[model samples]
Target: DFFIEFSRQGPCILSRSILQLLYLPLFNKVFGTLNFADVLKDAAKNFIFPPVLMPKSTLLLNPQAKEYVDTFLTHCVRPFGNLVQLCGHNRARQRDKLAHLLEDFATLQDEGEWKTIEEKPPPSSPGRDSNLDLPVLSSLAQHDKRVSQLRHGGGGLDVDSYHRTGEAQCQRAERVDAYLHNLSLKSDSPRPHLACFGTWILYHTLRVMIMYLLSGFELELYSNHEYHYIFWYLYEFLYGWLVSALSRADSFLTEQEAMAEIHKGRGTKKNKSKKKKTRPYGREITIYQALQNICGGFYKVHIM
Candidate 1:
């Protein structure tokens, strides 16, 4: 009851007709003699309190109701609805549970029941076609190449290729190093337009790195001599990456707003009166840039 009340009065919704079509029968069975839709309608009578008695913005438990509503609708509900309609009952979604489904496959050998008819290739020389040519992830060598590209301002990458011999010259870069490398490549592509998500992931990855490194200082984990290298790393990598990510996100938001304005100009004037709001990432870029400047100052002082 509390949950229903919360959701009804909270920051989100479903149309009554669709709701009736979907949930009314099940609810009627549970309600027995009672009228369910009438009960719901009655509960919603005070869903919006009169302006004289209470303002529409009066928050209950959540202070940031608008933000939460936007996130849930944009990030959760819309994606889920699109996915359900596009890929209904997809068997590929069950790939992660293969171990449990193995019993369903026809038995080929005493060791195991399998789906594929071809003989398994040798462990040392695994066939590329064995896995059905599903999307492969960027390799360490690819990561190195991407990081090199990002580092050198998107020019030709000069990094040595990773080979299976001789001291493994291609040292694995950090996870953020690997991820940020892909942003430049994806920015120009049309299909997977996930720059916003990419920026968010980069922020989180960089945050984790900064927090872990900061925690080491609090715990006295490093020797005095190691401080130089630690601070140097902070000045060079963590702060710079965070600022770059914020700038990318900020620019993307700007482009999106410009497109929205163009649409608005094309006759959609419903939201014309609403003033432009500052995006959170713009403030974040300013904050991180200031922090980077401070880090640079400290690094210079250490050199003196």
Candidate 2:
């Protein structure tokens, strides 16, 4: 009963006091301090006089009084940037957790069951046949030929071909050195594309910071529904906008890189043979057509 009354009247009383403070100038000008203090004293007198409904024992042993006092103190208390510092600390913790989770997921992928299927066996076949099975055999032969052609002529592995397992540490160090050297030359060379890429990275970092702060607060202060809603709303808006902006930035960068490559004449070669041989029926009819022709040629064999 005491808790119910406190819950109902506590917020109302606090709200009225806040409104009165806001109109302090008008009250002071019109009624002066004497009338103001008298009104204030009367209000304070209500606290001294226990409620008729409130039991004497319950009034003396107020369970919610401490909470109310803490609430009042929290509202009145002023700190020099403490809230900002607290928020920063929470964001940092969240960032650390997110980083750790990503690292763990990567490690799990590297050590997972999918590694077992890295080796695959060649297809097997039984006995060979004569001219009767020529069409079927020819189709199988064509499929094999196509597979071999792709394996031998496909754009050869670039990164994996250069990657060395035993010397990975040494290779990584060399790559880092080269990267730093290129980065140092950027000021003189002025690669606008790389600058934009760096800016995009920074933008993503800020987005992560915002996400981290919101998630951290939601997890820690689950009871603060209003704060949770505000944080989530801000996070969703910022995240969506950042994602859209990043997508546009990525597309723009891709176009710039493509144009740069074109200017340098550094794109994949156009296969004239592939262009000419696109429509296969022009070159030679498929085995399926040949089989149908043979079947039609020997309708008597089908009857037998």
Candidate 3:
């Protein structure tokens, strides 16, 4: 309000008016009315007097000038300095207080200071059994046990001791046979030793025997080509055999039927009049004729 009033009148007019008001004894006397009575009623109450001394001091400091810089600085600049210092402090509590103070001062300018008070009780911790009450360890142990059980239970069938022993011996024999066979095959010439020749012949003979067993002896008899020749040969041989057997059985049945028909005298054929067969013209001639007919029709239409 003071600043607004100050701004309404030009600064020069405002300053001259304030200078004239400061020197006027009448203005001081008017303010002194309440103070004069307060002094009579109770001398202590006179201490709460209006701020008329500020302007009076400005007049004494500069009698020739209309305004003094110190009065303006004291009224405006000092509070701003206090605000800056309050804001600059490193303490959090002081900084927060200063911010609230600034907000109050900005809103309530020359009015009294705004005060805030808060009463909060100190914080206290919960009891000591909190960590032990957590279920993390128990849950982890259960998870681990479940994982271990799955690992053990998911392993495939376990062979018995006797079966494992027999399998091991068979595998060893197979490996030795393979090694000896490879060695014999790698030899430049046939050997005279009966055991060597016997082994060589046995290996190949066993291979052929196994091939026959696997292919049912059919592929060996029929096929000469080597690429899946065994499988196709075996398939063809089996199919042919089956068909031959079925045909033989069917022929026997047919013979029986024929004999029955003959015995019943129902097998004779009757002669019918014959008709000569006409050969059909080839598609090329038919197509050419169709094309000619289409062309002639098209030409006639075009001429019309």
Best by lDDT: 1
Ranking by lDDT: 1, 2, 3
Candidate 3 lDDT over 1-304, as tens digits, reads 2332343344554464454344332322213243222222131112111111222322223342223212222233333333323322323333344334433222222121111112122122111211111111111112222221111124211113212332333332233223333443444421111122112212222222222223322323222222122232223222222223223323333443444445566565733654453222233234434543544454344334
lDDT over C-alpha atoms for residue 10 of model 3: 40
Best by TM-score: 1
Q: What overall lDDT goes with each candidate model?
A: 0.36, 0.30, 0.28
C-alpha displacement of 54 in model 1, angstroms? 33
- Estimate the TM-score for candidate 1: 0.38
Prediction 1 global C-alpha lDDT: 0.36
Total clashing pairs in model 2: 0
TM-score to native of every candidate shown: 0.38, 0.24, 0.14
> Tens digits of per-residue lDDT for model 2 on 154-221?
42212222222212323322322233224434433323222222222223333433444445554563
1 against 2, candidate with superior TM-score = 1
State the lDDT of candidate 1 residue by residue for 197-279, as single tens digits: 33443354355345445545655656654454456556665677677766655655566556546756786556647676786
- Candidate 3 residue 137 C-alpha distance from true site, Å: 64
Residue pairs clashing in model 2 are none
